[model samples]
Target: MSSSDGTAADASWERSDGRSRPPPTVNTIRRIRQACTNCRHRKTRCSGERPRCMNCRRVDRVCHYEPYSTTNPPSSASVAANNGAAKGKSPSSLFPRAGVVDISRLPLATRKSRQSSPSHRLLSINIRLPPPSPQTPFPTCQVQCMRFTTAPPPAVMDHLIDAYFLHVHNQPYSYFHEQSFRERVNYGLIPKCLLFAILASALKFSDIEYFQGSIREATEAYAREAWLAILHEHLTVENNPTLAERTLTLLTLFYIGGRTSSGWLKIGLAVRIAQDLQLMREPKNTMPPIEQEEHRRAFWSIYLLDKLVSVGQSRPPAIAEEDIHVQLPSDEETLRRGIWKKTPTLHQLINWKSETESSVNGTFTQTILAATALGRCCRYVLHGREMDEMPPWDPRSDFTLLNTFLLLIDHHLQVETPSIPQIVEHYRRPDGTLDFQSLEHVVFARIVFHTAHCLLNHPFLLRMRLQKSNCKVPPKFLTRSFQISCNHARSISSLVEDAIASGCHVQSSFYAYASILAGGILSLAIHIDQEKGQVTDPETLNHYQKAIHILERTGRRWDHASKMVSLHCLFRAIL
Candidate 1:
């Protein structure tokens, strides 16, 4: 029988019956080697890396390097754990029971484990935010759980994106030196996204007065065309089909001025490019032109276009009663005034339609006619045209128009996934880190600015209605008016303050826009007071203070003289 410590009187353990045990062998030592290192120790043949040995590696632990004698006999437990192979298994044995790993067989998995370092992980996490990383911000198929609720503000995210774009393009914002810019261009850095942002912003918000007053005087059609040509030339030079596809998607959301058929055609062009580049589809050996790939683009285009158009119709500008002259059309001249007219009273045009069936070039005659009619109306309002007669335009109910526009905007937001909030949180680490703090500031500024600007300063709508005199008024109308005015003022002020605090550089054009928006909101608040007999509520006072703070901060950076004028008007009207 074996001794109580389970060792025999030999180098290898033996049974109590007195047979000689084998010597401790290389196989046993090698098993111990792996077990030790895994446990980060030297070779020992014990079961616990706690006591690390050959037994330890098999049991998944380090082999302990204690002073246990190399001459000590193997225990029954150790031999049993090794399935009796420890005593006799050959060094060349492919199937050793001692848990020795084959280094050669593990080459691929080990290489992969080595390649996936921490930096790669961080980059993978960064790109999922709706704005994407600046270098390659396109969304991947990877889905990850995120920590935050809501998205990073768009203005802030845009800055981060811009930084990334600059880095990728290797274009330094530091120097406007033409040679440096050209060098970066040669290195494949074209500011496609930056240019796109500028154009889109101009298209969407450029007032006719601003266009006529400034741009028309400075730049001709040839200059604009040349700029576009440069962009096109770079897109060709880059041969970057993916970038082209992304550009198409952006244009679809922001521009691409047709509905239905034309939209489908444009989308078809995107899909064809995508196919050629294998971006959205498996490329066949051959490719087809836009006309041939009609089916691919038609479905998404029709669906997205209809969705966008409906949304556009919903956000019809809110008109007020006092802005329009109460009169009927007498002739074409009078009709022109009627076309420019705002609703003299809120419900007077409630039965009028915003859209009507008409013919354009083989496309959305209704949308084109509606846009043209609306544009004409807004022009008349801006020009202070004679308000003698109603126009020849068909009556479109205000409800129809407002609902359609809202729906279109909603659809675009959903499809585009721009500035999606939740995706941004995924980029943070476990302790909740964030990059591009400036992005947050810029985004918040833009949002607040747009909200206030669109509500207060849109040429077609009267968001604020100033009474000629604040004398007798119905209580309900007054209360409703106050509620709208107070809430909007508070919201605008709060957003502006938050934006400024985010450390958005006050000198940015975006910051200037925010200042302008604040000024307009303040003007609206003052107008509300004028309508209420020069009486300012506590909420109004609070909003005024907030607006003052924004002006003080932002004015230090931008020469917002027009904004100051608006602020002055606000004080005069209210006080």
Candidate 2:
């Protein structure tokens, strides 16, 4: 301003003087046109330059100038519109915002995003399909939307499904029915939660390590999605009992992948749902053959799980023996072929003998029967001890009840004993190592049976110890019980070592529990022998060390195994 005014005044004075004024002395100075966004927001001066100015470069800030325009700058919306125009599309069409779908255009239950990756995509694809009208056999629109949103490529889905059936479903205690599950997946009739659970389980069992790292993340994401879907759809067992039960069962497995406590919680929910569906009762003969068989299988599966979980967690069984009227499950082949056959109850099977084979022959039917007996024995022992320890207890009455239970367990063991030699012969190879893959279920069953025997006789052995300590001669029956308990404990340890040598210990969940049980008994025996000034057997000490090693290896995969290992170490130190 000073230069311009001074030059104008000098020019005006020269003109007034009517003389040709020499060019007014002028000074050239460059003015800044604009500042960068950072400088302008900070109210700092900036030299306008092509890339960066000295002021911005000195302070390590980016410098930029607004475009020179005679007209006003365009708004965000206008800029977006120009972008859309350049791409030959409307702005609204280019940017598809969530929650913009018209609710009135679809059924209330079908109001979910069809886009593959929604903000809540990992929550669950739990959108409920509207009930089909008499005019329509299926809710086509809902099914279509579900497929579009949650279903993976057919090839990938097929591989995962096959993997699950091969690795998980084929296990003796698994609950899923292959034919029905396959149909549901093929037709997109499965719930999103179940689908994700299946995928998570399959991925977990995949041998590829790269995929295993992803498995945990994918499982968590799918689990969250499934839960969100449940909430959004307001799913209840009353409205959809079948889906609810299936989802709960799959969720139990999902929890078993990492969180043992949560797995138990899901198993509890599954039990309640099974009861709600009247799965405790045998199916009526009037129902379709497939439905009848499926009902029977489902009930028995839940029963097996109830017993397994009870024994595994050292808790009482949820499905009472008296409450179940459903028959035992048939062999896998018969079930797979959809052949329905009436089977005897577990109690009847306990007394029933096969003339062709005196003991359980490692068949699925026989294994489950043995498991049922073992479960009952475990419960009786656990409950009997509780009763004996209760305030105002009658020692004579409790002892009588305990003895009666022991006699019953003894009879059950006698019936199951002959199968042991037969199983060992069947699975042993020429080289003398057990065929682990083929015999894992059989070995696990044997371990459970023997462990139950040990548990049943341990208390009697303790009584004998007390009697001996008091210088009173123990009864012949008490001495026999002690010897039998030691034999069973030794057998358990032998089986664990065999399984480990076969490289199949990790394949079964029972391995860790069986190892801990056997090790604890051996440790107790060693402690007792030491207190009596008797030399501890070298073989027994070796078995205890082997048990510790097995638990250490198992701990790498299961948190429960690690805890058991710690407890075993502490107990050993104390002894």
Candidate 3:
């Protein structure tokens, strides 16, 4: 067997038979293990990147280091002295005196010595070869080489991280059209794997205390590659997961407005990646829960509806025009006669070869929901209007379930804290409070937020006015009570009257909760006065002013009443 100290690490000796024997493990190989100067310079956790590192290419960098293994064996005393160090010393210190034991120091032993000590025959050590140096195509593997132990270079690390984020931003997800576009959609422009790699790289590169923790959580949530492998594997086909992950990231970014461009790009990428996944023929099911939902929703909302609408299957006869005095059909009748009543032709177009539950029906339902939301969004965007004038959209009630969800959400948000428990409990019990996140809470939250966003076009001042003719009690009681029991019918009626009369220009949307609140306050004032038997106008005015100030300070505006309807008139001068 050849000695390991003075020859290239790959060199081997021929055995008596046909096979070649590995070079002997030398003092230097034991001392350095696989650690090399280049790896230390780059601070890369090397997988011993073969030919070159899969990780380095992801970041657009060159991998370089000196290969320092040879065939010569060091003396027994030298080996013993080096190994005698505390077990805690690193495995790469088999030569005690040399910081990095050079292969040149130990030359191969003679054939006589190999024969004399057959048990001591050298065995080859496995160490990664470094990439080529500038002067040579092959890496420098001199018998004598310098070594140091430290992290990788900062510039190299920066380059790697930057590459990772770029890759992620470029991941592809395309909109569905014809089957012919499948290849372009799936593999076109950017791929999903690149997007994952970017996120993983960002988390790895960030110096924040929670970066690692976030990566771990994301890895579990996104069902993507591990953080390291993002850079480690780059954009290879095996690494790409799904578009849902990209969509989820995009949605969060849209909501939060953090890293704006990066977030939006992720959405586009998700669309492309999703199309890629759709075209895949293999049976696979390792998607994360969030992704599964996004995938289902995206397909239904984006593609299936177009197909249905194209074939006239979803069309409804136009409703006859009538005067304002004519009571239009109830919201339920309108929806049933107009949209939901018709069956659609979407089923045929979406029947893929796989004999599984048809995605078409689910897509159809989702598309309808999406269309409704889109209508609301467009209405507000164009007309600058609110849904307060329209009937609620409860699917279970006269309205669609989606509309009811919006109403509940509006009611909840109008209150001080929009807890899911409190909103759910409002329908269940007026006095009870609930805690904890529930499925009902999440579903409603989704429905309400999406619909409200669709409906609300512009921001406007929200004001409340308590009527003097109806108030005999303290106003504080009314504000507190009405804010709590937001749905009490009588209170809502009173507030609506106040909002209509209030001269302050306001968006009609604010009237819903604000009107109810004003009525509750008026009732409270009336009750207080009745309890006292009689209250002077000045005293009533003082209470109204105090309560109004409280509301204003708390971010609740109530300036809508006519200027003549002053604080003094609020309690009707019941001194």
Candidate 4:
């Protein structure tokens, strides 16, 4: 019965529709899913993976696996063939079209040579990044890409801004209109460049405990952040030119960066930008009164920088006083209240010798006037405008005219030289209010006033003036000049000492050198007295020591001051 049935089934199958029903391709002897088709063809071990195996995935092939039943078991021969296959090795060696060599079988020399060839190696890539630096943890690109949210807390920023305005803004650097700046700060509209720049310089003056121990490092760190912000702004490239000007000047006004060679360039760039905006010229009458006052303030600030940064005549001031058509800044009350008044010019002040005409100028205008006079003195000294045929002793000489100009400046400002120097007291009221703007004006006016006299009586300039002249200089003239210089130098030191003691430090950058110059002069005078066989008095020695001490304190805040302190020649007689 079985033979007859099998014969009938075989005949039916042979005559079956071969197109409709397909036959099993393999003998089905291999165990189910023991190997994938690709792996099996390469005689390699399979991971028994579902859907797609690693070997198939690597080659981008469609994967297929045969099914099994519990009722039926696979042969041991199939299992053995799969088990002995190569493990963890690429099956590319089995196919000529794979285009990858089994480098493990290659000789040592050939493998090493191939290993060194980037083109011949596998296509997989490896990337490595450098560790962060200790000083600047974030690169500019990293900060930009990662979005640095790590600025000083808003409270800290408020204090820093206060420090800047109170200590820094009062110097001739009063380009910022306080009302507008404070309004912008309240709105959180200030730029990071300007914000960070203020923080950088003001950290030294800050009372924040967070910045207490490491003032230098914190200041430098903020400066670096400000630098990054400035570079980032450059990408936007002058979208806010006023902000750019203010930020650069704020940085130039206090940070060490503004004092470097680069800072000098920044000064020129800033002044040029201001000039481009017609800040060098007077604001038109059609302009808003408040806006006109703003432009006037901004121009005066830049003008002061020009005067202060001029290193004698070797580096001439960018703003020629003759070229300046803008008026001096308004009264502090007018500026604070937005009440703009047109102030007078240097020429107008010089001509006002009439006793009946009380000057309408405030202390700030006096600062401008004093700085103007100082500019003349620097140019006079550095230009070596020696009356070669006529001695400086001549009453009609340019030197004598300059001396007269200084005295006229004193007269216009109504300056009374007090016997014992007193710090400016009105900057703070009875209830602990700071009239910082007024204070800055008064303090800076005094400093620039004294600095001018000190430079005028500088022995260096005196020698030059006497060098070229054939006239016999009077010993009395020389002694009087020396005494005047010593007196003014002492005055400068005393002003610094009393101001600091009163919790009102002078905020001007020029004070760094002014204090040093004063100290230098007093030291020389003491030694000169010693050379004349007179013993150095305790008061004289004490004054010199106080000057050095003040300088050391200044050095902690200003990099240039530190260098000045280190120079042995700066205090040659004492050293």
Candidate 5:
């Protein structure tokens, strides 16, 4: 909430009313712009403290703050007007109320409720058109629907669209090419479901207005409207790609985690749609190269999401590596230029040799490679225990295979990826807009890389593997793996530190999960040290603090992030 109230000078001294009322002797107590959820619900004064406020502390609860949109205090003139049957009442929620023109009805969208505050904007939009014209291009039914559509004005859509490319257009949620999507929006050619999906997911980051108060509500509102729009749409071979895009967008609403999204079912639908379109295989006909890239990028985007959303969970990914046959996507630049180039398939990248490392690898290609490694790492942790098992120290074991795959990924990163600082610098354009897609690959690569390391050497996983096999493993190997996990835990924190310092924000809630998972390693160690009555390493504690810091920053935008902050502050290690 940017404000104009604080800068007026001599306000206290000038008692303009000219009654015997004098200025107060005490100075005003400054308050934060918004209160914590509990304080707001209780209608109590909130100190707006970090992590936990005084009221939350009193109740032994987590202090949560979803990004809020509050209307400015009404002036006396407007206050008087609100009482009358006036033409211009202030907009109530961020989006308009349903069936209220200009406070338009929702589109084909989802209506699933989340565990959040009720004081939220219903995600809806409206354009307030003149009486229907014969020249209107829409069908009569669509024309009727458009009058109640709650879509924002074009100017606001511009901001939300920009935010989408900057924040939501990369990693676990990449569905559209920047150039093509913007062109569609410019031409009024984008599907309502896709447009609203982008708006809903990008709303929290946009910080445009106070939708009555809760931005999350407004965001979820957009999702609901998009869902409504999609329901009436006829699903067919030609519409399968758009349907996949819509489903993936809905799944991305789960970024902050929690009950906000039905990721599994949505992603399954998206993946199956891509497979049905034969997106996994390269095109065989006279299809343009640009069209081929679109198909490849779309499929890989789903693949990237599958890899990210499935981590630390029990189920397998929808698109297995073996099932994918298309070449990986090209770089952002080429995609923007609508050009395609020779690229490696998933297998070629995974089975890389030093002599045959001649494939042209771009940022997106690197991201795909990193995601594949992450998938393999996850599989190793969750399902690598084959019935015909070998000793932990054996060369032919699952552990060894994981190590080998990790090395392959490391080699590719070393060969193709830019340094973190270089990527940050590259993100800043001369025109002042950020090239977030470029920076996203680096962020995703680093996050996935370190997160996989943390997952691989997780102490519980280590202990379970050893216990299950009952094999005589070398102490040195086990000791080194522990060292590796600890190093990567700190590495995860370092990634956050660098991201913040460089102003390259961690855009996804999935990235925050990495930091939390990394913190778990240190948390387990400190807990163990406490049980043994020994001193924990100071350096380890510092890294743990950094992890918490990222979570706190993310919490301001995301409720689940805020919830995690509350949980971490209590110092429990369900790592």
Candidate 6:
């Protein structure tokens, strides 16, 4: 053989000798079995320690292994046997029976058994088990049921309830008592529909945009659920319609938050229900003090709602003054202390002396009384004389109704005047703006009074203008009434601006209504000045602009504000 060929053979032999040989049989190294089922499902690395693996131990999961079986499939009869053996045993507890043990006691035993088991034993006994039932994902838990029906988490619910009481229930005309309401909510005694209504109303005032969206959704859901619940209860329940009254009240409040006309209709239903419950009449002597107080509160609340709706809508009041025999509510302290004092009627309250006074000095009760009186005057002005009955030809007959309303106004002023100075002293700020938060009841009362005054006198002023056109001199009372009405209009506009400047959260509807009324009057005054070829007062024009600004601000929260703005524009154009 040539040396080169020998060298090549030697080199091949040397390379073969230097390189390690592959396994003779090419035996496959089994992939190390994956960690237990849980760790594998979680896609986490597992220590592969037998029995309960490290990952499962850390998370307290049921660590399990699959048993190795031959590649040949099991017989159907063996499968049937296994199924039969598993009968009556829960899937979780299908291991060999040690005894009928309480599952509660298994945890300690499980830990000890897992700790004491030999590694070899754990590896040998790879008991296969069925997969766990599918779990609800965490996000799905948030909206498990209908969003409205689902109870909020306890902390969130508590916060909402607190916000409702703080911002809503403390309003001058609101009726809810915080302590009783909280107790009812905590005990889950409030019906779900009513609770949702309250939540929707409360959330309307939340500063958060998320909560505002929630309010819109919740309000729609509440309307559906409330109607259904009411129908169901009416069919299934026997007497006692107290729930109906409460549900109606909550529905009214929800509508009120939106400043919808539907709130007035809801309040009418609430009034009828209250009447059915005998809440309009004085409570019986035999009734418990708390029950009596509750009746008084409910009745007056309905009365307050009637006034607010009537004035806001420019409609006649649904509740009449004579029909309300229930007394004013007692102070919170008096009610809380369980002291039973003889509640007084409106007449008696007007005549109350220092010696005879009970603790009826509560802002809520006082405000209701003032509003009720103002409401009476408003009804007379709006609907007292049926125009249908009036002779079509006589302008003189119009003055007859005006004269009577003026007397009623005089009576109210006389009774209410004594309290006005005190209210002014308490609420007037150093900057001459009224601090509405400190005296919301008084501020609202004054606004209502002035609104009624302006409304009543406006017709007479129009009459005076017509008479002036006919070359008939206007009566002294007519001219005086015109001047007084203009003064009241200016006063209302100033008060509203002051309220806005002071950062008071007065009801948007109230301020909006007052602004439109005042603005209309001031605009009329400007038109009259232009007709006389006199220069328009810049101050009056400025006041009208401010009133319009208020309406625009109110439009953000109240639907009625937009309507009022449209109406004011039409009226201004006509003038």
Among the numbered candidates, top lDDT falls to 5
How well does each candidate superpose onto the true structure, as a TM-score?
0.30, 0.61, 0.28, 0.68, 0.71, 0.63
Segments in model 1 whose C-alpha atoms lie over 4 Å from true places: 1-396, 399-482, 502-518, 521-535, 555-575
Query: How do the residues 111-194 of candidate 6 rate in per-residue lDDT, one tens digit apiece?
Result: 355346443133222232112223634332223213343444444466677766655664554555556666666555676556
lDDT of 4 by residue, 1-575 (tens): 69999999889988988885675677655444466544543456677678788866765545554333211232454233223332333332222212223444445675565567543323111111122344665443332211111244344666777887777776657766777776766655667677767777677677776554456655765665565566557425756666566666766765432356666777787787787777867788887777788788777777777777774457667777777777777787787777767577655666655433455347677788788888888887765443545566788876788789888888766555432234244445678766767766766777787888888888877887787675788888888888788888887887778766666657566787788878888888887888899988777777788778777877776778778888844447445
**lDDT string, candidate 2, 1-575, tens digits:** 69999999878886785455455456845556665543543355666666887765864533545434311334455344334333543332222111122223333333343233242232222222333344775544433322323333444567777767665553445555578767755554666666766676665456543233244554555564455445434354335665566666666655664577787877787788788888878788888666676676666656666666666435677787778777766555566677677676655555535332333333455456556766766675554334334211134544445445445434544534445456556767899875443355566666767766776677553563344445443357566666677777778777667655555434445557767777777777788899999999998898778777777776765557788888877866776
Candidate achieving higher TM-score, 5 or 6: 5
Sort order, TM-score high to low: 5, 4, 6, 2, 1, 3
Better of 2 and 5 by TM-score: 5
Q: Any runs in candidate 2 off by more than 4 Å, and if so which?
A: 1-159, 170-172, 209-212, 223-238, 253-260, 286-291, 312-314, 351-362, 383-440, 459-480, 499-506, 573-575
Which whole-number lDDT from 0 to 100 does residue 250 have in model 4? 65
Best by TM-score: 5
TM-score winner, 3 or 6: 6
> Pairing residues by index, what is the TM-score of model 4?
0.68
Question: Candidate 3: misplaced stretches above 4 Å?
Answer: 1-256, 279-419, 422-575
Compute the lDDT of residue 245 as modeled in candidate 1: 49
TM-score of 6: 0.63
Better of 2 and 4 by lDDT: 4
